[model samples]
Target: MTALAGDRLPPPLAEGDRLTVDDLALRVRVSGRRKRFALTVETDAGLTLHAPEGRPAAEAEEFVRAHRAWLVAKRGLRERTRPLNPTKRLVEGEVFRYLGRTYRLALVADPPAGGKVNLIAGRLVMDREQAGSPAGGRAALVDWYCRAGRAWAGRRLQPWAARMAVPEPDLEVRDLGRRWGTYRPGDGDSSVGRMSLGWPLFQLPMHLVDYVVAHELAHTRVLGHGADFWRLLRSALPEYEERRSELDELGRRMWMGEMS
Candidate 1:
């Protein structure tokens, strides 16, 4: 949340902050230590310009112009690899998955107390009134995922924590934007930690869900995705690389509450 370039340059943003070029919609980052300007295309197709502190706006603009050709090609490559999460229609017989099992939407006239989805007889029984509208159906379905995912992850957390030999952190399941899961370390003396998983993760197979949980649990012992972290995770799950690949491939295609 650094500075965005405007007519007049504001004071230098905090070290290593985001500056934006409105024309290209690419971000400009200013760092005090940076001596040379560099261009990078983020995995998510985000363009970034790493420039030294107090660089002129015109100069930055020129740097971007010089690299426009390369930028376009790199961006195209990134766009091809980015996830194309499909939207749901929220109608009768619409397909959904829960832990790798397929269930068709079955709208029922009579809904229970709340508009939560029920897994009854291999069908996702949702309220017809609720599913009549895209907004309501999307909300109801996401709520179901959050509540159900919490319980499932809660039961599965302790076992993974025990296997990893790390203290179990508080777990939450909800929309985490583009990330599958995240973990924040707590003070060692009293706090264990905090872990969050996107509700959409529940749509993946159990093994992949377990992979996300275990991946976060490993952070309890190791911080970054460095060699030490991978080594620690490998000790617990020998086939972690395979699981990671599967999750990456399958997770992107999972339903993310988008409606048609």
Candidate 2:
């Protein structure tokens, strides 16, 4: 008899699994480095559970069942706060947001040669040619937002960096998907840091904008959201928690691009 392969090998462990709890489906992932189990609910990704490696699958299912009430409530809240997908056609009377203000689009033929966008008299004025085509209109609008976002960040970063005692990091405004901003630290002591802020931030108020900047700057001192990070952030913005809450509430609406 050949020494059976099954007798010499250990049973396979589940690295990934899925289960349903109270009508909510959860994606379970087992990680070798995870010391404890945790659950995260995201707007786009739904529910996910992380368990310590080699833990019995039955234990993970039981954990979900234990927190069934909390999971159901959180998922319901996420659905209520989901952003609306507004019409994207570039047309006159359409609304766009900037620096927490809504401006209506106004198409004009004053500048016949080239197309441009400008916020004048509470209106986003655009050349007729630019407004006639969706691509042209979106490009002009996005270009304006990018320029304005950079200028706005430049003005705020200097003061905040000085207050936080961190070197001013390079700023880049772009779509950051689900994130408001990200801080990329350089390789070593001699490296310069870079911070990429989402253009959607322009749709929020200045106080909230400052909170995001301060949050990223604080990362320069502490990498994680430990007690030290909160302490440092509080020293700069005492009401940061309030601002953060407001930001979260307004986040979906801002991304919707609808008139307030």
TM-score of every model versus the real structure: 0.71, 0.70
Steric clash pairs (candidate 1): 19-28
Instruction: Give me the runs in candidate 2 sitting further than 4 Å from their true place.
Output: 1-71, 112-115, 256-260
Give residue 224's error in model 2 in angstroms: 2.6
Question: Model 2: how far is 213 from its true place, Å?
Answer: 1.1
Per lDDT, the best of the predicted structures is 1
lDDT minimum window of 10 residues, candidate 1: 10-19
lDDT of 2 by residue, 63-178 (tens): 88888888888888878776654555577897788888888888888953433988788898888887776766776777777788889998999999999898888899887876
lDDT of each: 0.86, 0.80
Off by over 4 Å in 1: 1-80, 113-115
Where is the poorest 10-residue window by lDDT in model 2? 8-17
**Predicted candidate 1 versus true structure: per-residue lDDT over 1-260, tens digit per residue:** 55566655645434445555555766777778899788999989998888788777667777888888898899998886778788899789999999999999999898666546888899999999888888888988999999989999999999999998999999999899878899998876798889999999999999999999999999999999999999989988899999998887787787777888
